[model samples]
Target: MAQVILTFFVAYGIVVGGALCGGIGAFLTHKPPLLSMELLADQLKIFGIVGALGGSFDSFLQIEKILIGNFSPVVKQLAMIVVAFLGAHIGTICVQWLVQVRS
Candidate 1:
């Protein structure tokens, strides 16, 4: 359906955009954006795209879980968006550091 496709596109965009921001931040800080391609490949092989996407949207998922009954819909959505960006940014930094240290 159109809705499902649109949703996937939006999620992908958010995740990738966050990653790009993180990479840029690292570059600005003079840190190399090192990534372990082999490990990433292995994770992809095991988890598949759907699983990876779910992982990337963890902030959204968690926020949805915790805020579903207590907060206004708009508030929950906005909070998730903020958390997702921050989570991805932090995740990228940690991953790059891990790869750089391992290699």
Candidate 2:
């Protein structure tokens, strides 16, 4: 329960933080900050998900455990992954909204 919620926020933070930092970089480079933020948000989503999951090796280990008929951990891991995805998606949407509002 707590882990899932933590995963969600961590994933969300990754996407939002990465996008904002990328936007700042774009501004410093004389490019369009909002567009860069949108792009970075999209790009960072997968990274966020993977990061929130703490990398793929643990997931693969979970899958192996599933093969051994231990289903609980895998289910929780899947739930965490789904929640992370949602968090990343929402973060992307937020960044897009920021772009839309600024434009």
Candidate 3:
């Protein structure tokens, strides 16, 4: 139980840190959404409330694995999940930069 709690804490920290960095970087980049160029263009509709803000983007990749019928080990799956999240956050920040921000 302690180990499980510790793991959860660690994971939480990483995710939170990543999100903060990503969000701030994204703000600095001021890039618009790939799907929408205007403010409040609404990009979350694509996820249909399933993947709301703060949710890890890794989820999509896990779904992809299920669709692809590719069986990865538990550890590998976890790694992929982490990778997905990191990539998404980083990519989001980059996108923001590309669009250019006013503030």
TM-score of each: 0.35, 0.93, 0.33
For every model in order, what is the number of clashing pairs?
A: 0, 0, 2
> Model 2 lDDT vs. the true structure?
0.89
Please give the distance, in angstroms, between residue 99's alpha carbon in candidate 1 and its true position after superposition.
11
| C-alpha lDDT of candidate 3 relative to the true structure | 0.41
Show the colliding residue pairs in model 3: 29-96, 31-96
Compared with the true structure, what per-residue lDDT tens digits does model 2 show for residues 1-103?
Answer: 7888889988999999999999899999999898899999999999999898899688767877887899998888788889999989999999898887454
Evaluation by lDDT, superior candidate among 1 and 2: 2
Best by lDDT: 2
lDDT of 3 at 63: 55
Which portions of model 2 miss their true places by more than 4 Å? 101-103
Looking at model 3, residue 62 earns an lDDT score of 58
- Give me the runs in candidate 1 sitting further than 4 Å from their true place: 36-103
Between candidates 1 and 2, name the one with more favorable TM-score: 2
- Extract clashing residue pairs from model 1: none
Candidate 3 wrong stretches, greater than 4 Å: 1-35, 38-72
Tens digit of per-residue lDDT, candidate 3, span 12-100: 34433444444565566885333232222123122212232235455445556755667564445465445444443443444445545
